[model samples]
Target: MIVSNPKQKITAVIPIRRGSQRVKDKNLRPFGDTCLMELKIRTLMQVPEIDEIIVNTNSEDAIRIVNECYAVGGVKTYRREEYYASSECSGSEFFRNLGEVTDTDVFMYCPCTSPFVKPETISQCIRAYAERGENDCVSTVSQIKEFLWLDGKPLNYDPSNAPNSQDLPDMVALNFGVTVIGRQDLINNRNIIGKNPRFVVTSDIEAIDIDTPLDFYIAEQIYRKTVIEKLELLE
Candidate 1:
């Protein structure tokens, strides 16, 4: 049976799908003796700030796995329609209706792609959001420290007068590691981040998002070295 914590107020909705053409079973694929799907639940379960977790996916395997092992951890699966997870689905209407899946006033859209998001980041952001009233949303971002280009133009640096990489102004991209937004704002605007958003800065390592075969390989190695091996040392 599913569980809900009325006092916490904020719900965590994780949207993942069965069809992964790039990495193939990306979420369920093995990593450090566990998969991304398992690790994500394990990570969120550790955070006291997140009381309820709804895994919104169209995968039967995913639903069964969560219900069997993770339901007790306040994790449950929402049976998303197959069409909505398809490529033909309309981005605007489909995303807007996602907020309707649950009635929480506020929710955190947790992406399963980002595997290394720290519990401290999520907990701190939630506390910050609760304290700040002026900001409408709290979302994670990673600063673009690399030299960027748009067409032929230098986006953040000059070619000939090359300045030190550290000297460049802050340019950030949505890392989608931790995103908290109002339910009404998502339904009304058909957006994740609102007009006024509070950005939570994450490190490049934490911002590793898996979308391709190469990404899976890279993240798997990193997780093993930085996480699994370290844990083994203690044992």
Candidate 2:
């Protein structure tokens, strides 16, 4: 078994909730052949660098699924407070809450939303994060070189003197496909990405995080592309 350093254990912390305003039971809803929760847990299990996997959730169904299929192979479920899982909460304490739950040396915030985040990508991120320690957090992001607009203004370029999109400064957006940080750093910062965060660039398809109904539908189509067109994995 490929393991983390004995001094610093890496645990995958997956937080899921049943009450998704955008899409009901998103974590447990039928996806491709398996649901998001099951798919994510399975994906994490493939990463040998991850020492442990914890499915933190407020849904009984999510807990049941984990206990049934994912309970083995260092994967288990942790019941979190329902209030913390609700939409009303500010979510500022998410990392701090995770810090309070477990004492693992390192925490990988692997959300189930990004179902397409490849296992190899996750393993690579974990390997890179092993060297970061408490100094830096490693996260997956997609480089956006396209023209961006904000509050009636060009965010990344001047419209009059626009350069080719390729020539524009690459703006990295946090897709949250995966985030690795030390427990202490998570507690100290109250966020997964601390002050000194290193980014691992992921492909556009792998960076898809299913949030809205349209996002869920699009992800399903992207996923089904495998069976429909016989495309290569995540191609």
Candidate 3:
């Protein structure tokens, strides 16, 4: 049962698969006390600008858990096919399917691995896309100053220059936490990034994603230390 919000027109699509090569049961694994997907749902639910959220997965346990504990009126689940559950399955395919079902003007692609993604960032991406008017896709990015290389060779070609990180022109990389895409571009191009892609720069703190056991541990610690304190104050 997906809740319909007439105020906002954006739809959020979260594609979660059962197969995880690095960490077993990654989506269902507990972060603090709640499962990863549950926390992701909680985060999405808090955003006023998100009209609806759909979970695309095939795992029986995941469906059961989400249905029992996380099935809100605005959140719906889609059963993915075995073919789409493969390790080679492209996320773009899921996004395409979701686009067909919702027909939303703005499609937000959020990953369940990033539990700490704030609603503010989600709203920010939405506003950025709408205001830009010409953007086909918008994604969060972090500026990096570290030495980069390709094929065992330096990329910047200046080994001697150790300029202050702040002084150097920022190089941005997709953070993959939150992506806002226009429906028309995705349909026309079959990709997130169309001809005009917007990059929203974000802080490193909002970019922590859980991929391995170590990553989970670090996220858990960070949540307990910082988010917990903030929540306690709200209480």
> lDDT: which candidate is best?
2
lDDT of 2 at 102: 78
Task: Give the per-residue lDDT digits (tens) of candidate 3, residues 1-235.
Answer: 1123234368788878886678788888766767778888888898888877888888888888778876755678888777777766676775565566555777888888877788888888877877766666789887887777799877754668766656665788877889888676676666666677898887777887778889988888887788777888999
lDDT of 1 by residue, 1-235 (tens): 1113245467888888896788898998788789998888888888887768989999999999999999877788899987878888887666686887766877888887899998888887787677657887888998977888899899898899998999887989998898887788888878787888898889889888988899899999999999989999999
**Cα RMSD, model 1:** 3.3
Model 2 residue 31 distance off true place after TM-score fit, in angstroms: 0.6
For all candidates, what are the clash counts?
0, 0, 2
TM-score, candidate number 1: 0.91
Give candidate 2's TM-score.
0.91
TM-score per candidate, in order?
0.91, 0.91, 0.86
lDDT: the better of candidates 1 and 3: 1
Give all candidates' CA lDDT scores.
0.83, 0.84, 0.76
Off by over 4 Å in 3: 1-8, 91-102, 229-235
What is the alpha-carbon lDDT for the whole of candidate 1? 0.83
Between candidates 2 and 3, which one is better according to TM-score? 2
Q: Model 2, 131-220: lDDT tens per residue?
A: 665547889999998888988888899889999989999799999999988889898888888898988999989999998989998998
